[model samples]
Target: MSRNTTTHDEFSDRTILVTGSSRGIGAATAKELAERGGDVVVNYRTSEDRAEAVVDSITDAGGEAIAVQADVRDPDAVDELVATAESAFGTIDVLVNNANISFSRTPFLEHPWDEFRDKLVGEIRAAYNCTQAVTPGMLEHEYGRIVYVSSEATRTVRPGFSSHVVAKSALNGLARSVATELASEGVVANVISPGPVRTEASADVLEQFEDQLIAETPMGDLAEPRDVARTVALFASDDASFVTGTRTPVNGGLLVE
Candidate 1:
């Protein structure tokens, strides 16, 4: 048993692979996991340089990490990503489906087919491919955690984020179904919906409404990436073994029903 029952000792001896970890929520989540003693495989699509910086930060902090490049949109690339992580860390015990291209400012009418393709299809493919890739190892160990980084957009229906809302909503449904399918095998899948987190990607999207958002949120400010990452860290732990097939809202009372 780990000195911290916050999760389990399996995490100490385990590796977690986080997609799109070069920045934003992904980077924050990877750091949080590493801080908790998990070896981290930081996956990035383009920012190998940024990825290395994140890895260096983790190492500097006495955590183990490596940067792995994979365009999550490509199935073959995701397969290679799984192989690389397993090779580097011996096994992948957790998968954080955090790679996403933001569509916050693109309204439904203004959304181009290409932009929609880039956001929805890319995320869906990434989640499906990566989950499939990491499952065998998880099953062999009879334990795994898959946290899909979703958004509060599904609940609030942010007008300009139609594409993102649709895509993230699909992820919720995908998680529920997969959770049911995998629950018997000791694999858990869930979603963490963070309301308006303040990260490089969100700073641009929330610029105009930042003040209004703060006023509306009960927490009186936008969520930080670490807020959501901490939730991911919890879900990735055995502490949440009984939790699955549900969305864990990390929002600051923005869309509470």
Candidate 2:
């Protein structure tokens, strides 16, 4: 493959996988890394067109990228997804565990049992599945970067976001543990905790509460998907080689951590 036509070729030899990248932060991250010269694998559970569009955006810009379909919550599917990407480019050196997770805003008692269980189990399972699938090769190569996309809600839980808080809160611990365990082996792990982002999925919520959110944030604005993407790329790049086990917030100053 030709080297990515960007200013820096640091990622020209790297292969990255960003799950749930059909849109939002994941899509922006995939594009960001590709632009930095990495061959990127865009993973999505559904939304083929959106995923392909992400790939196209990269390739059109003279970067290498491909879209793969996989439900990261399933180990088998993750295995297949990693294998396919590896076959196409090479072993994945950077795994951005940005799998899509949702908040079912209901009081704990009112939350449906199945939805609660699914959201909780599904989030952790997806990260676990992808991590297990790619880390073996990363170990063999002696280099890896794992970034988890978490939420600022974990810090100060919202009234109706018990499940979301629980799930996201787990990621902070998981990332730290992974970093402690793998840092010696040349693998670095970190978390990006973003606040209410202005994306299609959150448009309704933002439409109703954007004014209040902006007022509360010192930055007086919401985070764009690309804002979180840039921070994720930093963790994935050599720039943050010494930055591990951190839950860096990309919330436009909404929360000071």
Candidate 3:
């Protein structure tokens, strides 16, 4: 790494895993962590090509990274994914719970039963799986940071976003509970709720809601994936060791008004 690059020994010996990191917020957060000197494990459920691409980008930029595949909804797969990261980098230091699948917005009355199962099971189950998998490693070392990528929809309460909002809210609750349980063990957990990030995933859902979102947001601008990624990095960094058990909203100052 060059002098211009920061390979902070702060995390040089650590492995940071970001789930669903093939693209979007997960990809951005993986890159950010890698750039800061942590060995990165990029976990993807299906996007092998994109995951490898992210790995290559990190390696090219003088950082170490490897792509792991797992359906986070499956507990066994998540355990394997964590084992792969441990085998690659020795110890897991930071785990970003970013593996989320978006379901179409539909009124609760019109929402299909399958969508509920898919959205709820996918989001909440994955969080539980990944956290459980990496937690032992954190406890062994007596140091860890867990960052959960959540949504502002929990606060926004968008009409058609019932499932996602509910799932994210549950995720935040989980983080809070874990923070209290794990703080005594030197582990800190926090949730980042980003509003209207302009990622490919968000593009599909934002078109219909951008106007309403922007009008409601105090900053009057859409957030970029990088914006949310930065906050994830912050929460995972030593700077936030004292911060935990709370919801941090990065919605361009939205939800305040």
Candidate 4:
């Protein structure tokens, strides 16, 4: 993707931290926020090259960015990540919890309990750690945006995604609770649940249901990472100050309410 120059300025002089931003939706979000005038910290667990590429893209576009390495699942690492961002750009005004593990589909009955437990713990714990690390800084500044990238599987009730759905559902609940507790303090929390985004992580699953998904979706196409990133940008901007505790679906009408 080419560098986007659309400027919103809502994030001017602000700083953003996007976990797992080395690729896909997270990468797209990091670029989008940077384009809109936010200095960004690109956090990646294992993709240093990709993370630096993201930073280079933003900087090449006259935006400020830095690549930081952190495994979001580790509390100590998360704390260090937040500290690194603070040291680089003062404070993180937006936190996007987009890092997650990709696992092969398995029937709930046949799936190993250990695998299920690991998936849930990994997904939920990462978000918990990142949130805990950033909240204190946000509270001190009296301004913040917390966005959790979720999935439609939580509500669509699809098979073969038992562990994924449960973990995302828990993330939604966590966002809501955080929103309620932080709304009065100028910090807003929300979830952006995208249905079947086209990414390496979802390629296998999308291949299995491409025809059905396209037919069911009113828009007749799967979402690109940029599609979800746009919604995330909205939530991360100052324009969404009053919007909290809500899950905005970027599913192209696949499961509209």
What's the lDDT for residue 50 in model 1? 92
Q: How does model 4 fare in lDDT?
A: 0.91
In order, what is each prediction's RMSD in angstroms? 3.7, 4.0, 3.4, 2.1
Each model's lDDT comes to 0.87, 0.89, 0.88, 0.91
Report the candidate with higher TM-score, 2 versus 4. 4
lDDT of 1 at 65: 97
lDDT of 4 by residue, 42-83 (tens): 999999999999999999999999999999999999999999
Which digits, one per residue and each the tens of the lDDT, describe model 2 over residues 1-257? 12232346768889999999999999999999999899999999879999999999999999999999999998999999999999999999999999967767899889998988888888899898898899999999999999999988888676788888888887778888899999999999999999989889889878888999999989778888888888888899998988889889888777884
Tens digits of per-residue lDDT, candidate 1, 39-60, equal 9999998899999999999999
What are the runs in model 2 whose C-alpha is more than 4 Å off?
1-7
Q: Is candidate 1 or candidate 3 better by lDDT?
A: 3
Error of 2 at 51 (Å): 0.5
The reply for model 3, stretches above 4 Å from the true place, is 1-9
**If scored against the real structure, what TM-score would every candidate get?**
0.93, 0.95, 0.93, 0.96
User: By the TM-score metric, which is better: model 1 or model 4?
Assistant: 4
User: At residue 79, what lDDT does model 3 achieve?
Assistant: 79
Error of 4 at 110 (Å): 1.0
Candidate 2 residue pairs in clash (backbone atoms < 3 Å):
none
Displacement of the residue 82 alpha carbon in candidate 1, Å: 0.9
Candidate 3 local lDDT, 1-257, one digit each (tens): 11132344456777999999999999988988888888999999889999999999999999999999999988988878888888989879999999897787899999998997789878989999889988998999999999999988887786888999888888999999999999999999999988788898877678887898788877778887777887888899898999999788888777764
Ranking by TM-score: 4, 2, 1, 3
